[model samples]
Target: MILVLDFGGQYNQLIARRVRENHVYCEVHPHTMSLDRIREMAPKGIILTGGPNSVYQADSASCSPELFRLGIPVLGICYGSQLMAYLLGGRVETAPTSEYGKTEVTLRSGRSKLFAGVDTKTICWMSHTDYIAAAPDGFQITADTPVCPVAAMENEAENLYAVQFHPEVMHTVQGKVMLKNFVYAICGCAGDWKMDSFVRRTICELREKIGNGRALCALSGGVDSSVAAVLLSKAIGSQLTCVFVDHGLLRKDEGDQVEAVFGPNGPYDVHFVRVNAKDRFYQKLAGVTDPEQKRKIIGEEFIRVFEEEAKKIGAVDYLVQGTIYPDVIESGLGKSAVIKSHHNVGGLPDYVDFKEIVEPLRLLFKDEVRTAGRELGIPDYLVNRQPFPGPGLGIRIIGEVTEEKVRIVQEADAIYREEVAKAGVEGLGQYFAALTNMRSVGVMGDGRTYDYAIALRAVMTSDFMTAESAQLPWEVLQKTTSRIVNEVRGVNRVLYDCTGKPPATIEFE
Candidate 1:
């Protein structure tokens, strides 16, 4: 298994995912983890993940000296690379000119394993105040940019390697190629890991872990939970009860798709329970202005309803979730600052009693989950479905959330997705319907009135964590906007979101 030592950077999980995508098993542990424990794990190769802190900081984090002498293949990224060099007696100094954003780095040695099938000049994402001014004793400097001299290095002769820039981010044009070279050429790991093998292994492992014990799962109809449900049902049969809380915030015809794939056509037993409390949710959300408060209310209420229904089925021994790697990283498990917490994170308010939890996809990526879904014969509707926020349509609505508001948003959102599908754009990251607070003047059958403004958002992202605004063809955008404005009632105006995923998240909230 590949070991990814985390320095608390946002891209740590993405690095592990890339390794796994290459058909090799990998585990992520904090730099604070014990060296003895890591040695026991016996990782085939080690990858150092980037972090927020500079190595120059007085109290920044660094790895033990023993980590460098592990005698295994090692790869470092961004701050981790700088740390590797610093720990090994390489000179690191604050750059007179710092490099950030997209920049080109030319390879110094063309006959190396790291540059296999990659272009001589590659576009890489760079962000650092300090850089490696000199290399370690036996390291070869292989790449450089205008800002940083020691941009890349290797000591493959001794199974040690390091790079000053990130190879996991999309801005790096040959990022995947560089990683493929590491996992394949250096690590010599066979590219045999696939969706079928992962599902089969997970099912066997889950069955052994929960032999005859009942497992209860929360279904949100997203790809992650739906795939987890199928995997668990295959392992424990009818012992799994899936509770889907309908807070009236899902997309058009979404509930039906969930029932169709995980319910009837599944290979395992599935007890489907749908709780529709649109009226209660709307009433409770009235006059709420804060987005975080709205998300908390939705989460808290969902838990209340789920536990109540769970009582009818008697005590469950386990709570299974489709929690993926990105969710865990964004949760900031061992990081300094709190980013954001998913519903399943931090546990049940320290009051509600539940048994041990099961998260099958805890170690997998978004693409891996979809692959597993397809392996289990899950239909295209659920397998290729776009991601929706956990807060559901509540976060998408700018003003107070109500049943009528959900209906309007749902209709408008449905129209937007259907039009996109009609345009045959297969791999878009996220598409959402936002109910803006602004009102627009409209004439319905010669009668003048003011109505809600509905905005359509769709973005393309190689990774769901960060994204750029999707540039829908002018014709496609015009068609989507016109259809929403004309066909969807109560939606008088339609607008496209132009902002990317930094200052604004995929969801407005």
Candidate 2:
């Protein structure tokens, strides 16, 4: 296993993801983790992640020099490199010019294990103010850029490596190759980790933890929740009860589709209860427009509904949520600002009835969750289903949500999805239709009409945290717009959203 030591970097999780992609299991812990614990874990390798603070700061994050003496391969990145150099008697000072974004780097040591198959001259992602002015004694300068003298350094005999440029990000042209070399050639990892093994191990752990206890799963029927439900069922079988709440915010016919899979008539052994709280949720969401407020209301209301259901079953030992890594990070992790509240994460109420909350897939990213889902033998359609927020279509509508707005968005979304599938447009990470609050004047069959515009959104992203707008074929957009305007009527025009995740999120609200 590879251990990632986090120094509060934004891309720490991305480091773990890249390691896992090498088919080697990895986990991230804070830099403050005790050395004894690290020794006990005995990871094949250790990675020190980048951070915002300068290593020379009085309170900067650092690790013991003895970490290097442990003999386990260590790879330091950015601030991590600075810390390593500083702690090991190497000079680290403010760069004459701070390197940021993609920078051209030249390899100084062609024999370096870290750059085994990498090009002699390559572009790397650089983001650092402090530069490694000199390599520590016995460490070779492996790579360097114009501004950063010591872009990468390594002590091959000691199995210590440091890179000022970020190899975890995609901007580093051959970053994956560098990481693969480190994990395979340097650390000697077998690269045997697979999702199937994770599935089996997790099921065993879940069974052991919830033995003789009742687990009430908040089965949203999305990929995450579905995988969680099935995993729990495989573990505890009859001890698991899945409660699917139809809070009127789901996509077109989503509630029924969910029921058809997890309900009693379904193949699973767990008890399935479907709560049709459409009007109940609508009543609470009446006149609500603010996106955060809508998310919180829907989130709390979901808990209350589950509480009512749990009470019927006497006592539920645990409440299972499909909260994935993106939900946790975006909802706010440590110093990271909250992008938005995920209903299962930040939007949860202060009080919950269950004895404990269990999130089986909490640490896995979106694509990782899908991999685990496939490993658990979940159906392909469900496994490959587009990601849906827990608050459902509540966040997809811009303003106050009414039954009419829900119907309009749902029908529009269904048509949008249908057209996209019919067009065989692959590589779309997420695509859906949203209801815009704006109403415009237009002539329909010579009659003047003013109505809401349906905004269709499509993005291509590996991780949900960052995404780019998909450049869909003009014909596909035209066909989708034509169908939405003609069929699903709150009565007006259809618009395509061209914004990406930075200026705008995948969802409208």
Candidate 3:
């Protein structure tokens, strides 16, 4: 496992993803962690992440120098590199001209261990106010950027490598390649962590834990839970019952898709239950405007439905869910101090009775989940499915989650998704459709002006923690706007979400 000492960059999670992409296991820990404790974790290597704080700041965060004694390969980035330089008796001074955004770096010595690759000139993502003017006694300077005299440094004696820029971010085109090279060349870790291997091991583990008892699973029709249901069915056939609850706020054909996956081609006995308690949900939520309250009511109602279905299944022993990693931040079900959860948080309620919970994909990220699905022979159409909120279209609607409101949001959302696919951005982070509480006035035809407004929100983000306004191609946006206004009635005007994820959230409550 590779250990990353977190100095609190928003992109720290990206650093972990980069390592995992190379088929190596990696974990992030607070920089306050001691070398002795880190050594106990037995990591293959150590990476110090960049931070908003500078090393020269008196109140700056610092870790013990004892890390060098472990004889592990160390890669320090940005602020991390500054700290290493400071500790090694090198000159770290605040630069008069701070390097931010894209910068060019030129390799100085090909013989340098850190610069063994062929590139003599490379573009890098640099954001640093402090510059390293000198290197410690045995350290050799490997490269220099347009601004910083010593952009990259290496100490072969200590097996330490440092870069003034972050290679974990996408802005650095060669960042991923550089990281892969480091994992293979420096640490001797083979990039062979295949999804097939993950499936086999997970299946074996699930079987061992679940010997001969029956299990109950909560299926939300999302990829995570659907994948979990399929995996559990494969592990213990006839011992699992899949339950899906309908609160009437679901998107168009969402329920049908759920039925298709769980009813047929399902490896085990799949039970499909639809509870239409939309009125009860809306009545309970009457005039209560808080977002958290809305989520709680939905969550509570969902649990009640699942419990009602589980009773029919005759006292199952386990509850399986498609609980993926991002669920932590999404659902806000629990506090994960590190890594914000997406809309997919905690799986069953505390009061409900079940022996033990089994989450087959709990350890896997979103990408890994889809990859594992394909490896298990699930169709790409189902496996590469777009992400949907577990609350269905309830939270996606602004005012009240009536059946009509749900239908409008679903249709608009589907249209938004269709055009986004047509836009063909290489790595679009997330997209969604939402309804507004207020209406706008407009003229439909020759005569009178009418009212109503629909919103289309989408953004590109490395991690859901922060996001940038997705500058979708104008032609695609215009086409999408035209369709929503023409095909979907009651929507006189269509507006795009230009604001990013700070002042605005992914979902407009």
Highest-scoring model, lDDT: 2
**Residue-by-residue lDDT tens digits, candidate 1, 103-143:** 89899998779878878788888878889999999999999
Give the Cα error of residue 329 in candidate 3, in Å: 6.2
In order of appearance, the predictions have TM-scores of 0.92, 0.91, 0.81
What are the per-residue Cα lDDT tens digits for candidate 3 across 358-387?
Answer: 778866777888888888777787776667
- Tens digits of lDDT, candidate 2, 158-198: 99999999898766889999999999999999999988888
State which candidate has the highest TM-score.
1
TM-score (C-alpha, index-matched) for candidate 2: 0.91
Clashes (backbone N, CA, C under 3 Å), per candidate, total 0, 0, 10
Comparing 1 with 3 on TM-score, the higher-scoring candidate is 1
Give me the runs in candidate 1 sitting further than 4 Å from their true place: 260-268, 336-338, 346-348, 439-451, 502-504
Of 2 and 3, the candidate ahead on lDDT is 2
Query: Each candidate: what lDDT?
Result: 0.81, 0.89, 0.75
Ranking by TM-score: 1, 2, 3
